[model samples]
Target chain A: MSRALGIEARDRRRAMLLTAPALVWTLVFFVLPFALMAAISLWQATATGMIRTWSLDNYTAFFTRPAYLGAALNSIEITVTVTVLSVLLAYPMAWIIAEEVPRRYQRLALTLAVIPFWTSYIVRSYAWSLVLSRKGVVNDWLAGWGLPLLDLANSRAAVVIGFTHFFTMLLVLTIYASLVQLPPNLRRAAADLGAGPVAIFRHVVLPLTLPGVMVGAFLTFALCIGDYVTPQILGGGKDLALPQLVMLQVGRRADLPMASALSIVLMALVTLAYLAMARWMKEPGK
Target chain B: MIRFAVSATYMALIYAFIFLPVYVLVLFSFQDGRFPIPPFKGFSLRWHQAVLSDGHLMAALGHSFVVAVLSSAVSLLLGFLAARGLAHARLRGAGVARGLITAPLSVSYLVIGLGLLASFNLANVPLSLMTVTLGHVVINAPLCFAICASAMGAPQLAAERAARDLGAGEIRVMALVTAPMILPALVAAFLLSMTFSWDEFIIAFLLSRFDVTLPVELWSLLRSGLNPKTNAIGSLVFLVSAFAVLAAELALRRRA
Candidate 1:
């Protein structure tokens, strides 16, 4: 029995040893950095450097400054628009891929849908900038068709368009996974009960796949809200999202305290999103 | 018939919308003229040649490759060990450990980059590729851990037990038995991490100084001016990454 106890103890030690490196890495890199950021957020930024005095000056400034608050609002607006548009657009594509496409071709179709995602994200946004430029493809194409050119470059619309394009692909993948996992018999059963296609879809298909939609939407919110590249490249300098604001504070102002506060705010938004979507974000079999 | 037609049209439009930017970017990269905008001005390889010869861009590319590979390899190793330890051992606080490892996934890249930058500054560690690589590891390791942990199952546990029963050492059981058993997961984790690290902008942007990554270099290039060279470099990155994604998919499909 003592030998068995010794074996168990040794195994426990081994497990600890195996997991220690990762734990330590996460502690030193991830947790400690986040803690430092939170701590720095409370510190006051002075002319020469950060003052050790703990204050709410940065957070207060964020709330009181119209530009800062506007940036936050812009971020929320863009994120919401992107999330909603992505879901609306992706649902049909995901539905078509799962329900309409031939089984053998479904994988190919999905791959083609998300092929652009393989491109560098920064480049993708830059590509959008080129595409939406005054003398760019869309305008050129419009001119070809005798249509009036629209000014989209460096606008919130352009940012939304860029974000929607990427998130649509992501949402399609997630929603498609859930759609395909749905047992076909459920639909057949609904049909046997004399429910029409729309009714069956609304009641059966939609409810079952709502979790996937929620998961995808929440992810979109988390990513889109915190993204600096998309807005910086596409939103032009006319408008600033929260992330752009954070970068501005860090890069130009060298206000580490303000940047940290802004980051904490952004983190809080993501945390709130996660809490809201917590029910549907669990592992599949969980 | 009308519903089918509508769906087909919608799909076509969406596909067009999705491919528009990629199409424009690639087409303009070959433009003989300076501007990357319309009026193709006939195809030319000048921009591609320019990208290939530009020492700064090439150096940035090499730096990106090194950071991606090293960070991804470290992430995969740490993730695999953690996943294995959690899967096999009925240890206390496993749930907490898993949570801590996977928590970074929910956080944004900007936030992670900012946090690391702050911490590194506090430590008086000057920004370099090493710091950028460390930042990448911080972001990607959680992802690797999640992927590896999800792929662990009863079959691998049984195989591991069998190896142990055969008087194999713990390290041998892990290296020779468990590792091979979850090779697909490991590959997937590594490839995914590498892909993220390669294209990751914010962390590398915030951390690196002289040895900037490709995305950071591209950012400066984009800011410097509107040149077809930017288009060429972007196209090149797209082509290489697309090839990698295709290869990974093919490998995973074959394994499955």
Candidate 2:
């Protein structure tokens, strides 16, 4: 036999041995820092610096001040809009690639779809700002059509467009992966059972791909809510997103405690997103 | 068919939408005027040449490269080892270990950066390129681990078992058998993390003092004014990244 008690012991030991360093690294860098931040969030940020006294003052302030609460609400609104919009846009493209494109060309088509994302993330936002600016390309194109100019730069709409552009690329790859994994015979079998194309798509294909869509949507939400660059460059820093508020606390005010509090709230939002995705994912299996 | 025509038109419109910003960015990088805005002047290469000569941008490029390479290497090594372990043996609490290792994937980069920043401030650790690398690893290592773990299923386990049955030592089997078997995953993990680190901004911006990465430098360049040099550098970045993605796809396609 290839397996024995001694070998089994060795295998288990080796597994532990192998995972130990990575676990240690994660503990030190990822987990410990989060723990530290949690502790610091409970502390107070004085004018001089951080103080050791435990207080809920930052969280209390976050609730009491309309600016902070409004930023959080705006972050949620923007993230949801971008997530749902990108998924809607991307699902069709991914479906086309999976269903319409020839097998050999599908790889190239997918690569082309995601190629724009390879650019510097910050540059992508800046480029969109240029395109959405009053005197930028969008307005220029409109002018050629004798249309009214659009003053979109430094607006929430500009931020949503930039974010949608990136997230759509991401969602396409994901949804395509799930789409291609469906066995061809399953669809053929459904057809043989006399199901119409639209019916098959709704009942069979959509249900199967829902998990992937949810995962992509959750990723979009997490990334969009935390992103400071898109809103900073395109939203023009006039209205602060949560990340911008956190950054302002750290960069201008040097309030580590307040930043930590803001980050904890950000983490909480992401955790809620994760839970929701997990709940939705469980339904597809049923 | 009407359906075919509809799909075609829709695809064309989407492609136009996808290419819009990139088209403008590249077109304006060659604009002959001071402003990057509309009313396109004649083409010129002055901004590209000027960006090439900018010392701070060049230095940031170098710093980004170093951080990408070094952090990716460390993350790949850790992730590969952990994946190999989880695949080979059933350690008690293996799920917990795996969860802990990959937990960072669920967290946002901003929150990760803020956590690191707060901890470093508390500990008085000076923010530097190393700190940025540390933050990148925290984010990228989990991703690397997930990719490696996914690629280490039945085939890999069989190969590793065959090597062990033939009397290969653990180290030899890992180095000579298991690793080579998952070499594609290792390479993919390394390359993908490099791409991420090279473009990552917030962690770099939050964790660095004097020596910033290219994205941070580009952000400042963008904010300092509306300069075509920013466009030039951005176009260059797009060019390199597009080439990398094309190369990776071609390589993987060939293998498949």
- In order of appearance, the predictions have TM-scores of 0.97, 0.95
Q: Cα RMSD (Å) between model 2 and the true structure?
A: 2.2
Give lDDT for model 1: 0.91
TM-score of chain B of 2: 0.94
- State the lDDT of candidate 2 residue by residue for A1-286, as single tens digits: 5667877887888888899889999999988999999999999878888789998999998999999999999999999999999999999999998988899999888878888989898889888988888888889889999999888999999999999999999999999999999988988999999999998998899988888888889889988998999998889877789999999998898888888999899889988999988887777463
Per-residue alpha-carbon lDDT of candidate 2 for residues B1-256, written as tens digits (9 for 90 to 100): 8988877787777788888889888989999999888888989999999988999999999999999999999999899889888877877898999999999987888888988887887789999999999999998998889988987888878887898889998899989987787777677778888888998999999999999999999988887766688899999988877766566555445545
Candidates 1 onward: DockQ, in order: 0.84, 0.80
Maximum-DockQ candidate: 1
Give me the candidate number with maximum lDDT: 1
Model 2, backbone clash pairs (residues 3+ apart or across chains), number = 0
Which ranges of candidate 1 are over 4 A from the true structure?
Answer: A279-286
How good is the docking of model 1, as DockQ? 0.84
lDDT of 2: 0.88
